[model samples]
Target: MADTALPGTRVKVPFAGQAVDGFVLARIAESEHPGRLQPLRRAVSAEPVLAPEIAELVGDVAARYAGTRSDVLRLAVPARHATTEKADSVPAGTVPPPDLAAWSTYEGSAALAGLAAGESPRLVWTVGPGDDGIELLADAAVATASAGRGALVCLPDVRDVARLDKALVQRLGKGRHVVLTADAGPAKRYAAFLAVARGAVRIVIGTRAAAFAPVHDLGLVAIWDDGDDLYAEPRAPYPHTREVLLLRAQRAETAVLLAAHARSVEAEYLVRSAWATSVALPRDEVRRRAAVSVTGDSDLDLARDPRARSSRLPKEVFEVLREALTVGPVLVQTPRAGYATRLACESCRTPASCPACHGPLRIGAAQAPPSCTWCGTVATGWSCPECGGRGLRAPVLGDRRTAEELGRAFPSIPVQTSSAERIIDRVRARPGIVVATPGAEPPAEGGYAAVVLLDTWLLLARSDLRAEEEALRRWLNAAALVGSTADRPGRVVAVGDPARGSLQALVRWDPAGFAQREIAERQEAHLPPASRVATLTGPAELLEGALAVLQLPAGAEVLGPVEVGDGSEEQRYVVRVPRTAGAQLSAALVALQASRSARKEQHLRVDVDPVTLG
Candidate 1:
């Protein structure tokens, strides 16, 4: 035992062709094993890569996510770099912290003020639509820094990180903070890691991976837009940003803040349970920031107005766009990117597919011919398999087609398109229309004069659990680009069913109320955010065997043994348990995973609290 290294320490061990770097899990006594074990080649790091508390956190996450220690460790620590060994000194700073009074103006921000003053407080706050997330985050960081402790703020993607970093550096000074993201050059990423590990930076801000950075004397951990799918890691043993921060807050006894314009059901769950205080603006403030309205197409006058319902620009929407464009650039939010993303046969009403490859047909632009989305073959000779129909119709329109329609309706007006392939971060200060897909909307120079959210039905039609919530988020995010306030008020027009809960919420400018309703509905339905759910995927036999052996917590239910993936192999099942029994459910799954690993059984992937149930 004396000859072996302790857990959390780095060591070199024999591998496929040569010695490879590894972490020592435990000390094994020579007497315990009769076989002659390979000696440790050498120690890799002078310091423990996993601190005692962080090591404990790794195990906790493994149990919670049904993941292995190594999976969590992959994000906890970065690969070793020689350049990071140089000693980095803490830079001096003394910028005036953000006005605490400004933050306290929100309905329940007093608790957050306490958090900045070194008191442990947990809060779920929603800034009104169009409010800058970076501003709130900077305020929290400044307060934490003033109290002489570090703060960690995580955003969903690099674009968000860039926005927050610019604000943090201006408020906290360049040297007092460090930026961490997966996109950073190896040396730059490791340098930031060294800064945090060495206690040289008090403010750590980055994307998903930054949630696990080893900061010293952590006083606050904050996450922005917890609902974004970008926060959910795509790799094995996926750990969501919101859950990770929650765990860290509990383990470190630090202040926690989950802020977003459109709150998630899970965040609202915390508020309901009284685990966190709710911070939000009053109704008047919300109305002041976001003056939203619904323009439904169901109106008889609207119904009688156009020949092409799918691409026709509503007269009301056109008037709004005309007015908005006269003042500044207007934004048109579309759900898809291509010209006509979905096609169907006019004769039979069946979905149109390419005859050559049976793939879905799409048009690149209004003038382009129908082509297969999968095989990229032009469907010039294609016929509908269902009715031998020669003509195809577009059931759902897209951004390019919408832009083309708008450009024709308002001739002499410049038009631009932004989507997956081409992304313009900022639109120029011109009286024109910038058509964009969701999440690809560009920032207008001074703020958009108005935003028209087109085709709202497409987003709400998704089968996922978060369809409505996500749709409102996308709409509000774009609407937020319009300047808000009494003096320079901005407007947003949603083209859809006005009776829908989400649309009504947007019109009333009440995201929190909407979220509360959503949470209540989920509770009634026994769905996630109200309950705990886990998904298991593997070979059919292995899945069944493991399911039969699992000691599920009381009241746990298994939903499916549904087939997934190619018919050659693979299937999936979902398990649900009451929120009160979440720990028990995870523990049982962890035990099953460990057993499978021990027996060298065929692999199965288990994910607890997955972002999507389907």
Candidate 2:
């Protein structure tokens, strides 16, 4: 059995009198057990799915996130497909040298050259407005492939993967690249995985899980829009895609590109720490391309139009939208997606709540009955708990509601809606209005004539630490889709307080500056990126037990055992440590988890550097 099943080989072994599937990590010359070891049940396959480098990455990620190795392996590898594994390997195609002219506009074009020459260059790239970031990534992959090395590009979702897939096909031709997304189904996903493992394809692109693609002789790992919440794994350990790719890059000495329209504090930290180089267009170039303005930026302007503060669409916003619609499609970005996501009493101004579960009530459609946002319980004849008034009013307007209003205002023009329920990938570059929620804004053929950001205050009002940063990111993502030129700069109008730092940043097209300021503020507050944080959530006694056993590193601070969830049994504890002591903190938490596991104790969920702390 030892001779037949080598390290990384899949095998079935006897565990507690039951046959369980497992992977061989290593072979030892002798066994330390006092009793004779049980014989192997059978070998599942001869193919070693877990490549050595990928196995090392799994271990590193597990240690970093304080999770078990098996859990990380589940994310790094795909389930086996017997027929796919037994099929003939596809031959690699010749990749033509990539056109680097597109990268010449940025100062970091040298990094791409270095990558093509087998040099590792870490870069934090800020894509310019109206630029096809997918094409840029494909160019990098082509450069890597031309040098006989592999490249991996991880996108936030299937939409992005599809865009990149199309770009790669146009550049690298067929069979030169493979996409590994869960949407491809089990058989096709397994086949794509096998193709990479067998060295059939040197270029790979997919969503989050593709960060672990075993591309042979890897030279580049590029991640797009790392700030998107989709990049954060919801399962145990909750490893973020950006962190995972950084770990892989460090271990394999591969070039890594973190590209996005808006900068994240984590990515900014990479540049500040000298771990990566910043790549962005010149300020003059940015000014020449993006024409942005904020409503209520000046007292004089607000005094001229007093209703701008209370009205959803101010007079100035309407003028901009009206003029832009004559030339091309106009994008109207709303914060929410439904008809009315939140409701309140009309007479008393008290929030409406579901009587069944005490959750906030919402309306999903026009004139629809109120329903609980939490449990989906319909509320009939519901009255406000704080007041006797039964009438309800919508204070927040979602995409659907905004679309309905815009359709009436512009009765002659067409109004399209995009949200989670229905997404429009692309619209014609004709005159129309496209109403969409954040992250759901579809691109136009050439580009939108203008983008109107509605309800900016709703995003800034979130009870989360990254609220401001997230708001800027969403705004920038939408604004970047507008077309621009030196003679006719793209227009972006944001309805919010002009003095707000995020709004000011959007007006100036300075995401990097905003991120720098954000990092400085976080440093003063001792928040993430400046320090390390871990959250432990479970039952009260379980959390207390885990905290007591943890050998916390010096300078570590434990913030809470705060009550959470629907009942008192559950609690949450926040542990923080200086950046220098992050490894020690992770190690201690890992030991605590191991101790609990050995004693058959209930495990607590652990999330390190979580996206939010609400």
Candidate 3:
């Protein structure tokens, strides 16, 4: 036996009823029953998959999320493909970073300049919504690389990664950087991982998993659009990418840059606590780059009309689109992607449901029969149960339907649709209608001539705690696509009440101020960003037992053992604690999990700062 075997030693061992690849912990130099120990099957790799820093990160994440160490490790170090094991090493190269000095003249650039000089500057940067953010992010990475240190930039998804990848390759040249994302498949992804792990690449850009990428000589960690839901890991433990980077910064004492079009309450908390500095452009500069406006039905005189509120494109929006189309393409942002998401009865104004299954009905086309969204059953002869109405109405419209409507409205022009399954990256400068759902809007070459944000009420009426905050983010992201005054004068018209804070924020183009107000509201309401919250899901008896032993901090507020599922058989409970005791709460939960494991109790699902309590 090797006396000096240590952690991160790759080995094969028994796992889940088979011999699977694993890693070594340490040597049992003085084990009480050394003879009884099973021999390590074999070594899997010649090098460690995770560096010491990443390994420590896995431990911290596991403890914080109350998740099993194995699960966190699984995400940290994905499975390697055999084909990449023999890949050749990458040669070094360098390119001068773009002029970031001009950015230093902006409000928050000094801290960033300090970071570029190899000082650890933790700052939250707010940039107006647009593709301009791509340049800002690439510049930050370039500065880090120029400082002779490796940098990791994490975006929300593969699409964002591709966009930033182009910008980086343009700024930093080719061999100096690598991108890590699952979309590239196992072999290519693993190849990139190995390249970074072997110190062949000094800059790495990727999605959520890249937050843990073992870049050599790490100096900076940057995350773009930190508020995107895609950054919220879906697997057990559900560690958010933003928090992971923050922890990495604290542990490694590296510079941290969090850039977003709209501020997240968590980011606001960091700034308020003085843990991170705030970076923003001057108000005039922002307005010069982005011209945003807020409009409502009243502005279009539709509020006086009894049936005008339900019209997808009110007269005002139609007029705006008509005028904007002459200049360039117009973008219409819808909430969902379908023909008709929600159907209703024309006579009674009642929701239409399928007779066969009594499920909510939706229409795939204007002439299509009502179909149940749940059971997929077509209701050819459906009647409104309340009013016996035969005619159907669309209460909520989706992108496909909006595109179809706009197509008919402007028969001479083209209408394009972008969404989750079918995403278009860029649209050439032309006179047309681009109908897209949130986050799926394609970038216009010269930027959209104008934008109409529809159904603001519907977007904000979600049960999630960050619903309003996220609505504004999506709106800003779409609006920011409008051209600057130099390229094409931009204009935006939102279809909602202008008095609302989110809409007002959009009008004023002030996300930071909006975030500050949101923080205050959350504090008053005792919601996240103000106070820590944890949700527990399990069998009722098991949860009861677990809560009985949970040593919560002082003044902890327990919410409910809310009933879930179909009127039977399942429930989930929520517990809240003061934000100051968040760490203590996590510690207590970790201890409880260990206790449960020791007694072999049934597992319980634990999530902190969950996006939704319902």
Candidate 4:
């Protein structure tokens, strides 16, 4: 059994008089131990499910995120399915040559040409509005497959996966590619994994976890919307999909394409550092593709509609919606999802909070009692803590409330809502209003005539560091669904202060410019993308102990160990360092964790380059 256990094969061995399962990483010629080692109890399977490249990637990811190798492996490789593993492998299908017509529309067709020639070319692709990115990705994948090399594409959600899967089938016949997502049951996912490992499939597409798909002789790794928080793993070590793919591209010399409607600061940094080339449409082409207008772009416009600042639906927005409705369905993108996610005193305008947990209170629907968002406690007879006012007012309007208001304003037109609870995949292109929260907006058949962005202040008012950046990304994503052309351009109306940078970026349809400005601002402030940051969260004593033992790298600065949560004992400490010293910072944190583990002390939660600082 020991002789049959090859690298990547699973085996069972005796450890401290107990049987333990582990993977055979390598077969060493000699052991350093003077005493004879115990023989393996049995080989679980002779199949090398974990490939050598994937094993190395797992180790690199663990080290980069300051996590244990086992933790990273758990995410890289799925749980074994015996029945699926025992199944026979399917034969590989022939892939047709890819047509490069679609690549001609963009300025960076060379990147696609490079993939066809089997050369590694890195690109930060900003997909333009009114474009089908799924089709383009399918073309890239086919180009790689035609060269007899595997391709992997990672999307943000299952809907995207389904869309891309259909496009792949249309481009490259059936059985040429496999879909790998957690939504697919364990058996099906394992079967797909086995197919890839056995070289039965050359193309793999899925969400999040698919970034680690072990495709043999990989030639390209592409990720769409790299800035979406969904790409950040919630598990320990919290490895981000973009970072993981970048590492893989660097190590394997594989082609990488990070495509999105809006650019993330990290992606912008890559372009600035000459690590990746920027692929985007010309400014004039962008304007022709996206027709965006902010409510108060000039003082004369503000003077013409004085109510624009105070009203949720300005006259300009109403005019756009009313005109667009005559042609096709109109999309309304709201910031929140519930009826009233925030309540304030009607008289004093003071925020309402729950007396029990001091959490903000919210109303689920009309005539519904206010409840605590954090503790879920119903707030009966709630009063403002600052003022003695008993009346409550909804300061922040959600999608449901916006839909109700729109329904009243346009009684003849039907109003539908799409949110987390009820997601609409597609809507007919008719004269109706579709109210949807960001990311939940369904694509309308023939495309929406116009998109109205409401409650823009709510999106920008968050205490998060990426509030503006995230708002622009969501706005671009929603606006991209509208169809546009040189003759009949799509209309997009945003109700917000036009002077703000994010709103200005939307008006000009310049996400790349916005990202450049954002990166410069962050660099000046010593924030992420320009520098590295790590957060330590746990009890105060444990966090302090961890910090005390940490060997600080040069130029590293330790910020406050501030109290977190609602007067809880938990505390958080932030460590900032230059981007060049990121590895050193991770190493120090890993050593600190090791020391705590050796002493059997409470471990601190350490996250390097966390997505959110709040």
lDDT tens per residue, model 3, 588-612? 8889988998888888889987766
TM-score of each: 0.92, 0.95, 0.93, 0.95
Candidate 4 segments whose C-alpha is farther than 4 A from its true place? 296-299, 354-359, 367-390
How does each model score on lDDT? 0.82, 0.89, 0.83, 0.88
Off by over 4 Å in 2: 28-37, 296-298, 354-361, 367-391, 566-568
Q: Against the hidden true structure, what lDDT does model 2 obtain?
A: 0.89
Candidate 3 clashes between residue pairs 3 or more apart in a chain or in different chains: none
User: In order, how many clashes per candidate?
Assistant: 0, 0, 0, 0
Q: Measured by TM-score, how close is model 1 to the native structure?
A: 0.92
Cα error, residue 601 of model 3, in Å, equals 2.4
Alpha-carbon deviation at 135 in model 2, angstroms: 1.7
Superposed Cα deviation of residue 64, candidate 4 (Å): 0.6
Worst ten in a row by lDDT for model 3: 1-10
Give a tens-digit lDDT track for model 2, residues 1-614. Answer: 65669888899999978999899887888888889888889988888888989899999999999998889988889888888888876977767788888888887778767777778899999998888788889888899888889999999999999999989888767788999987788889998998899898989999987989999999999999999889999877899999999999999988999999999999999999999999998888887777999884468657879887778888888899889988999999999988898999998888888898989899998878899999999997897777788899898988989999999888989999998889999999799999999988898998889999999999999988989999999999999999974589889999989999999999988888999999999999898999999999998877887888899999999999777756557888999999999999999989998988888998788888888876
Ranking of all candidate structures by their lDDT, best first = 2, 4, 3, 1
